[model samples]
Target chain A: MADSVDTGRPAPRTSTHSLVVEAIENRILSGELGVGDMLPPERQLAEQLGVSRAAAREAIRVLESHGVLESHVGSGARAGTFITSMPTAALSRFLKLHVSLNNFDLDEVVQTRLILEVESAAMAARRQDPEILQRMGEELAAMDDTDLDREDFGDADTRFHVALARGGGNRLFADMTQAIRESLRAPLLDGYRAHEDWSGLRETLQHQHRELLAAVAAGDAERASQLAAEHIHTSYQVLPADSGGSRRQGNRTAAGGV
Target chain B: MADSVDTGRPAPRTSTHSLVVEAIENRILSGELGVGDMLPPERQLAEQLGVSRAAAREAIRVLESHGVLESHVGSGARAGTFITSMPTAALSRFLKLHVSLNNFDLDEVVQTRLILEVESAAMAARRQDPEILQRMGEELAAMDDTDLDREDFGDADTRFHVALARGGGNRLFADMTQAIRESLRAPLLDGYRAHEDWSGLRETLQHQHRELLAAVAAGDAERASQLAAEHIHTSYQVLPADSGGSRRQGNRTAAGGV
Candidate 1:
C-alpha cells in the first residue's frame, strides 16, 4: 500500500477493508438498501461478508464518511448502522478540500456553479413546487434583513440559491449546487468583505433575488434562467480580482508542519 | 453522539473525535497541508491536538474516506498519512451510490449531465488544447471500432466527453462530469444493450462524436455546445423508456436483506 501510495495510485481494492466497503456498496447499488433503512449489526455484517469485526467497523466509518451510511452505538431503532442520503455534507467536504488545495481554480468553480444555478432556476420555474418556493421566499427575506452583516448575508444567499435548486425538484442538481455553493462560501464572503461598496453590491444582489423569485413564481422559465445567470455573473465581475478570489493567496505559507 | 445519531442528527462535531477531524481539516483548508504533504505521526498529532490516539486515528480514517487523506504503513516517505487530491474517485463513488439508491431520479441525472456536457463542449471549443484534442480523437476512434461491444462503446463514449471536459481546462467541470458519466456507465450500457437497432444507433452516435470533435477542433463553441446537447437528448429519447430506463425496475427486489 505504501509503495502504491509512493507511486501515486490507490491501494489494491481487494483488501479485507475494501471488500467490506464493496459488500455494503453492492447492496446499495443493487437497490437492496436505501435511506432510512438500518443495516444488520456490525457483527452480522462481518459474519455475512466473511470479514473481521475491526474491518467491518472501519468499513462502516468509511461509508459513514461517504455520507452513504450512519451508525449509532446504543441498541435500538436508529441506533445501528443505516443507509443515509447526505450528498451535501460529503460532496462539500470533498470539493472544499480539493478547491483549497488548488486542484480546482476559482474561475471554474464560479462558472460551473453559474451553469447549475441557471438550470436550477429554469427548472424551478417549470416545476414551482409550493414547499420549495416557500423556502426560497424565507431565504430571500433573510437576505433582505437590514441587520445582516457580510457573513450572514453570504450564508443566507447560499441558502436562497439552494432553495431554488430544490424548487426544481431535482435532488441531484440541488445537492451538487449545495456542495459547490457551500464550498465557495468562505471565499465569497472574503470577496464581499474586501469590496469597497458592499452596500451597493448587496442591494443589487437582493434586487436580483427578488426579481428571480418573481420570475419563478410567475412560471417564466426563460426569464428565471436569464436572471440567475446575470445575477451570478454580476457578482463575480464586481468582486475584486485579488484577495480571496484565488486559492493561491495563502499557498506559499503552508509548510504543513502539522 | 449515539443519542444524536439516534435522533437522526449528526454528532455535535465538537467531540474529541470531531475536534481532531476539524484540526486536520483546518490545516488543509488553510493550505498548511496539501497534496503530497505528510502529516505528523499519529501519537504526535494526538498529543499536539490534545486528543486521545483513538480519536486521532478515527479522525484520520474519516478524512481518508473523504478522499482528502491517504495513509500507508512501512518505513518511508509514503508510510504515514498524506493529504491527497482525488476528486473523481470520491465524487464518483458518492454519486454512484446515491444514484443507485434512487435519491436522484434518472431524468434529473440525464438533464443535469446534459447541462454540464453542453458547457464543457463550449469551453473545450474555446480552449482546444492539443493533448485533450488528441485524447478525444483517440476515444472517437475507439468508438468507431467495428468490433466494439455495447459496454466498450459506452465506456469510450464516456471518456470522449470527459476528454472534452478536460480540454476546457476546468478541473471542476471535468471532474464533476467525470463523476456523473462514470456513475451512469453501467446503466447506459444496459440501455445500449437493450436497444433494437444497435448497429444503426452506433453509427449515428459515431457520426455525432466525429462531428462534435470536429466542431471542437474548429473552435466553434456555439456549434459544439449545441451538438453536445442534441447528442445527449437524442440518446436518452431514442432509448426504450421501459428497459432499465427507470431506476425502479429493480427497486422492489432490494429488501436489502444484507
Candidate 2:
C-alpha cells in the first residue's frame, strides 16, 4: 500500500526543479501532453511554472534520463523538448538498482519472475508463434554449449527468458518480464561465478530450460506453465545464500530461501 | 529482448551530463554504490567524471528524479548526495506515460495484471496475514459504499488489490502490482466517466471484488486464483472498446480487445 500512489494531489515539498518535473509528468499521465508533443522553450516553461530557467532545464534533463522526454539542441521548432515514450530500460534501470541494493530482496524478485514467466510461457504455448520459437531455440542452443563461460552463459540465459516472454504475444508483459529478469542478471551472474559447483548448477539449469522449451515448442500450455514454475524454483534455489540474506532483516520474509 | 539490458557496455552517445549520469548508474548496477553511500562533492565529482560543474549538477538532478539518489543542500559533513532506494513511483511514472500514450495497449496491461493478481491472490490465501487481510477488508468495505463515486471506488479498488499483493508476503510483488494498477488510473477513470452506464459498471465491479475477497478470506488458494483471474477478465471486458484499440496499426496484434 505504501508503494501505491494516492490519486489525490499532495502539497509540493521538493525543489522548484522537482515541481517542474511533476508538472510535466502530470501532463503526460493525464494525456494532455502526448508522445512527440514538444514542450515550450526553457524560458517559456520557466515563466509558465514560475521557476528559473535553470530549474526548467534541470527538470527537462531529469525527464530525459527517465526517457519520458527527448531534447534536440537547435534554434528552431525542431529543437525543443518533446514527450517521448520510455522503453523498458526506464523500468529496468530502477529495478536493477533496487535488486542490487536489496531494496528488493532476492526471494521476492524470483517470486515476481515466477508469477510472470509461468503465465507468459502458457500464453506462448497457446500462441505457438514460429518466429518467437526460433529466437528462443537459438538462445537455448547457445546455452547448450559445454565450454560457455559464466558471462556468455548468462547473456544467453537472459535472452532465452526474454524470447520466451515475447512468444506470449503481449508487448507489455514481454517488456516487464524482461525487465524483471534483467534486474536479476548481474546478481545471478555473480551467484554463478561464486558458487562452489558452477558447472553442476549450469548443467541443471540447461536441463530445466531444455524441457521447458520443448513443452513450449510442442504447444503444451499446461506443461509449459508448470515447467516454467519449476524452472524458476530451481533457479532461485541455486542463487548464493548470502545474496538472498538481508542487511535489514525483518518479518517481510520468513525462513523461506526462495 | 529489446527491453533487455545488455551487460556489455555501450559507447556513450549523449551529452556530458548523460555520461555523468551513466557513470553513477553503472556504479549502482555493479554494487559499487549502495543505499546511503555518499556521493562525491559537486566540484570533486565534476573533476572525476571529466565534466563541467554544470554538467555534473545536471546529472545529479537527473539521478535525483530517478529516486536512485538523494541530496542534502548544505555546507557540512552530513550535507552531500547519497544513494537512495526508489519507491514504486519511479517504476509507475514511466508505465503511466507509456499506457497513456498507447505505447502499451489495454490488452497487454490487463493480461500482465491477470498474471500477477492470480498468483498474488493465491499467495494471499496461503499466507492469510491478518493485518493485510484487515487492510484489504477496509478497502473492500470502502468500495462497498452505495454512494461512492468512481474516483473513490477507484482508490479503494487500487488499495484492495495492492493489499492483496502485500498479503502474498512479497514486497516486490506488492510494489510492482501497485505500480501496474496505478499506471491505468487516469485513463480508466476517464473511461468510467465517459461510459453511459457508470453505476451499472460500478455495481458489477463491486460484486466481483466481494467474491474475490471472500475466496481469499476462506483461504482457498485455487479458488482465490480462479476468482482473481475471472475478476480481471470481467474488468477488462467492461472497459470501452476504443480505449483498448491501438492508435498504431501494426503486426503486433490481430484484433484482440482485452
Task: Please provide, for model 2 over A1-258, each residue's C-alpha lDDT reduced to its tens digit, 9 standing for 90 to 100.
Answer: 111123322213378888998898877765678776889889999999999998898898888777777766656556667776666777777777677667777777777777678888988998888998899889888888889999899889889999998888778777777778788776677788888888889888999988988998899999999999888887766566666334534343531234
Q: What fraction of native interface contacts is shared by candidate 1?
A: 0.67
lDDT of 1 by residue, B1-258 (tens): 566545555555565677888888888887677778889999999999888887787788778766778777778655888887666777788888877767665666777778888888887898888899999999998888889988888888888888898887667777778888877776777778787889999998888998999999999999999999888876775544443333454332211010
TM-score of chain A of each: 0.87, 0.85
Q: Candidate 2 chain A vs. true chain A: TM-score? A: 0.85
Model 2 chain B weakest lDDT span, ten residues long: B1-10
Specify the CAPRI tier of model 1. acceptable
Error of 1 at A177 (Å): 1.8
| Model 2 stretches with alpha carbons more than 4 Å out | A1-14, A30-33, A36-50, A72-82, A244-258, B1-14, B30-33, B37-44, B47-50, B72-82, B244-258
The positional error of residue A135 in candidate 2, measured at the CA in angstroms, is 1.4
Over B123-223, each residue of candidate 2 has an lDDT whose tens digit, in order, gives: 89987788988898899888878788888888899999999988887777777778788887765777788878888888888888888888888899999
| lDDT string, candidate 1, A104-223, tens digits | 666777777788888889888988788878888999988878799988888888889889988876677788788888778777877788889888999999999999999999999999
